[model samples]
Structure formats: structure tokens, C-alpha cells
Target: MASMVWTRYAAIGDSFTEGIGDLHPDGTPRGWADRAAEALSTRAEGFGYANLAVRGKLLDQILDVQLPAALALKPDLVSVSGGGNDLLRPGTDVDVLAARMDEGVARLRAAGADVVLFTGVDPAGSAVIRRTRGRVALFNELLRATAVRHGAHIVDQWSMDVLRDWRCWSIDRLHMSPEGHRRVALAMLESLGVQDAGDWREPELAPLPALSRGARLLFDARWARGYLAPWIGRRLRGRSSGDLVTAKRPGLSPVGK
Candidate 1:
């Protein structure tokens, strides 16, 4: 409602928080954070927003780099979503990572901000990512505990079954599509108890069509070649897509209509 809004909002995380798959007409990204900021602007005029998320960032990077900036802004609401990148790596102890994540949330909450946390989506749709589904589940469980311990709100994307549809995913099958980002923004608002007309839980227009045996094979090959191979190469070299990239909207600015 117009009467209730977070005057200052800061989002810190990885590609999910940075709005990777959601692209603007000018080749810029306008992820869920921006959508949520716009919604807040409509309700509370002059709502200021900052997004300090970059692609390929681990939870540590988020905490080390973005957390300080978010704290400096002293936002009324802070949304933090990360650790999906960490799950992709082998031998990653997510429980330990969850503990570190809890520290970040604790810091934000201690700064007197209402913090929001997110559980990662199940990546079972992808052959390469399916192996990490259990890890994702474990991280989600730990994240729930962290939220409870810190008195933070959660977006809970892991339980949103609508995200299981491939259409909600980008070509890389990692980041969310524009439609997915839109729904996430609605979900965030709903979690904050902000009433609006948007329906984030609406079903897809049509059921996904099953691919034929041959088509499935071809698709898998293409996916592996185009996205998976490059990603693996990056990991092998300890490189990241956000190696030199900085935050898209580093400073809090008034959201435009």
C-alpha cells in the first residue's frame, strides 16, 4: 500500500540479485530488485534503491564487498540472495557457507535494517546441475534456520514450484528469465506484506511440451557446448564472469515510474 514502504532499499547478492537474465531494451539489466524498487516507489514516493550484485560472485564476495556498501547506505530494507555459485563448485561445504551467510544477515539486522533472504531454486532441470540439487536443498534448510535466527524475512524461491518450468529459466539454465524475475519481485512484495494486484504465483499459459528423444539429445549437446563447457573452463581457471565488473546501480537513486 502507499502508506507502507521501505524508503531506502539495497539488494546485495550474485547474478540473481543483480538481475542477470532480465535485460532492458538498451542491453541493460532490470532484474527483480529494480521491479520491486519501482513498486515501492509507487507506494512510497522517492523510494531510493541500490543494487550491488554482480554475476559470478560467491557469498564471501557479497559479504566482503557489497555488505559494507549496503550498510553504509543504511537502507530500511536489505535483500540478500547468493551462494548458488558456490554450489556449482565441487567439495563446497554449504553448511559452512550457510554459517558465513548468517553472519552477513546478522550484520545487516544488527544495523537496524529489515533483511530478506532467499533460498535457491532446484536446478534438477539441467543434467549438469541436477547433481547439486541435494546441496541446494541443504543450503535452503540452513537458510531457513538462518532466517529464523536473525528474524529476517525470506522470499523462499526453492518452494515455488512454478519455477520448475524451463521457460522461467534463461538459456544458460542458471539465472531466471524476465518473467521469472517479475514473479520474484511480486513474491518479495508479498513477503513484505505489501498488498498489490500482481499475481506472482500464476500458472504458465500452457504446459511445457516434451521434447522428442532425438531433439532432447541435440538440445543437450548444444547446451553443454555453448554454456556448460565455458562455465567449467572459467571455474578451472578460477575466473568469473564478473571478474572486472562492478555493480550496475551502485548508489541509491530514486526509482522512476
Candidate 2:
């Protein structure tokens, strides 16, 4: 099995893997998994790809729901990334989350698929998610150790300074923008020893205009009304954004070619 050429690639996780912010013209999510699949297909003429990821899923939900399907696919490579949703909730224990995630990684490896794991990204657009930076760091440490123990490749998102830029995030302040997803796909391929399109890291842009205190407050209010409030409502009702959503790419098939 050459590191650069995988015949089949399966992705399992939550919104990030599902491609929330990067949407097609018809509104279908086309995320990093899709990009990686396209890149892999270029390396291998008939590459197959499946993405069993849904938006707003927790680490545990992904383990219970998506992992089984992924194992059944018997892909040569599997990308497993989750835990951010769990960490966002109040009083969530990241260590326990990490432990559960570690078990999932071990299971994937035991199933004989080369696994790729990811660390949570620090949010630059939201003060609320920004506050979780310390907790996210702790989880990333555990994730790194888990990858090492399970012989998995880690994407190391925590080490990427490009993610610190606010431009990388979508307006919802939770998911990455299309450009952000593109960069992540390139990074993932590079981590797997696969040559990608070009440099994932681009030159920095000029800083955004400084907002007055009143204008900043108004912007925060709009964000709360548009995104944060609805998210909280769903949490209170014990629902998820992915409640009935199915996998975007449910079966392995040729991509790019």
C-alpha cells in the first residue's frame, strides 16, 4: 500500500468532515473530505471515496453511527475527526471525550485501515469559542498521544498559524469557509505523504478594518440572533443540526475521474 495512492478513502466525523461551510451551487456541502478524495483520485486513476459524516454530531455519535458504516466499507484509508461539538457544551469533560475518541481510532486501525486524525481548531471569530482555546489545547495534546499510540497520522491543526486568521472561518463562527476547507484538504494530503495541488498556505491579507465599540457590539448582537441563539435552542431541545441528515457520499465511488 503506497502512502500516496489510496484506492479507497472513507471519512467519518461531524460537520467539519461533512463540509458545512463549503457548499456546492445547489447547497450540498463539499468539504475537505471531498477535496482530499479528488486529490487521491488524481494519484490513483480509479480512486473510491465515501463520506459518512453529518453536521453537529458529537464524538460519541460519530463512533456509534458513522464508524460502523465506515468499517463496512473497508476503505484503505480512513479520516476520523471529531470532539469539537462535545467540547463546546458546558461542563463537558474533554479527557473523557479524548478517551472515547482514542478507542474509535484504535478500532479503525484494528479494522486494518490507515487512519488520519485531526485536532480541534481554535476559533478566532467568536469570543465564546475563543474562550475554549485552553480546553481545545488540552484535547489536542490527548489526540496527539492517541494518534501515536494507535499508529495513526495526525493532521496537527493546532500547529497551523493560518487557522488563527478570522478570514478562515465562516460567518457562523463554527465551521470553516470554502478556502479554509481547501487549505485543510491540502494539509491532510501532505500529512499522508500525498502530493497536493499547490501550497496550502497562502500569503496573508491586509487586516480587516477596526470596528468602533458600538459597531462591534451591534455585530455581536446580530451573530447571537442569527447563529448562537439557534444553536443554544437546539441544545436545550436535545437536538442536532444533523438530526435527519444522511451522509453526503454514502458509498465509495470514483471521484475526479
Candidate 3:
């Protein structure tokens, strides 16, 4: 870690950062952020890491709750991810969210931490999700500007063509599968200037088995009913999947400790 010196690193975000779709053997999420910490810890001795990300959290909750707690740890490096959950809600003003994000990130920068931000993925691979492509693009631009303004590092998920595959996503189509999380971890390490961390840009894996058009239609229908419908219902009811959940790694501790 000659080029890096962050001894205490903290992550703050939602399910994406929490690694919801990438479950460990014990069924706990072990996502890219955690993998990033492990990689950094290997390079730098006694590195500390904390993740305050919870599923179904909005940008507001991330900043309101998690951000302060992360700052309390006085982390030298922090990754801030949000707005994907906000994008799912109806009438979510991308501009307003970006503005709030700007403020929150500004605070992190003012705290003398090297901050990292992520742009949302290009959902062109998902037929149902591609409809929001324009909105995601606009939000990503604002995030780029915010990063430039605050001197924060930005991981460009939008440019990850490797992620635009069915194999990279979980069955629910909302979270990254194990393969996706692996490449994303590589991407984060690359952004941090970690040499020889592996090429995240490389596409790998066999193609999914072909299914008849009728079967595909039925699968989509089931997915919509089983996952999408309830998600929308939760939004309408003002409930969140994270209501009963708390941060998985709430405090900064030695990596893998």
C-alpha cells in the first residue's frame, strides 16, 4: 500500500453496499465493500473497517443516521453510496437527492477523509429497469460533479460493461450476485489504485441456458409478482425492508477480527 494510507475505512450505503444478494455460507451478506476492506487490510497491516449499510435505506436515512456514526469513528477513508433506493420511489427528485448527497459528502471531505462515491449502474440489460436509464444518467452526472467539487474518488459503475449480464445479477434482479460482487470489488480496488488486484473489466462466465419465449414470459411474470409487486407495496405503505435491520458492521474494528 505504498500509494495508499487509509488505516480506518468506513462504508455507508444501502443493500448494495451491504451485499444483500451475495450471501456467505452462513447466509450473511458478504459484498464488495467487505471484500474491498479485506483486500486493503491485506496490503496494509492492521487496517480497520466498518460498514453501516442497511437494506432498503434511502439517501436521507444514510446521511441522517449512518454518516454521522461513520464520522464519529474518524475514519481516514469512507465510501458513500446511496440514491439507488431513492430512485425506486415515485416522485424522487434526482436533483434534490444529489444536492443532499453533495452536502453529506462535503461534510465527509471536511472531516479530512478521502471519500469514495459510486455512480448507479447502467440497467440496459434489464427490460423493466432500463426505463429509468435517463434518470440514472442524470443522477450520475450530478454525482460526478459532486465528486469533482469535493475532491472525492468516484467508482464509475455506469461504465462497467461487465455488469450488464444476467449472470451478474441475483434472481431477484435487484442485487448483484456473487460474480457481480466479485467484479465490483475488483473495480473498487482498482479505483483505489490497488495494483495487481485483478481486472474487473474482464467479462467471464458461461451464458445462461436458453429458455423458450413462453417460459421466459412466465418467469418474468413470477418475478414481478414475487419481488416487484411487494416492493412497490412497501413504498406505498411507507414501510422499508430495513425497518427491523441495523448496520451489520456498526463500528470500526480490525478487518476480519
What's the residue-level lDDT of 58 in candidate 3? 90
* Tens digit of per-residue lDDT, candidate 2, span 21-86: 998777889989898888788778678999999999998889999999999998889999998988
Clashes of each: 0, 0, 0
TM-score of each: 0.96, 0.94, 0.95
Clash tally for model 1: 0
lDDT of 2: 0.87
Model 3 / residue 163 / CA error / Å: 0.9
Compose the digit string of candidate 1's lDDT tens values, residues 1-257: 34356799999999898899998788888999989888887777668999999999999999999999999998999999989999988799988999999999999999999998989887777778989999999999999999999999998887888888888889888889998999999898888888863779885557878899899999999999999999999988989999998998888988742
Give the number of colliding residue pairs in candidate 2: 0
**Which parts of model 1 are misplaced by more than 4 Å?**
1-3
lDDT tens digits, residues 43-131, model 3? 77778999999999999999999999999999999999999988865588999999999999999999999999999999887758888
Q: How well does candidate 2 match the true structure in TM-score terms?
A: 0.94
Question: In candidate 2, residue 242 scores what lDDT?
Answer: 94
In model 3, which runs have C-alpha deviations exceeding 4 angstroms?
206-212
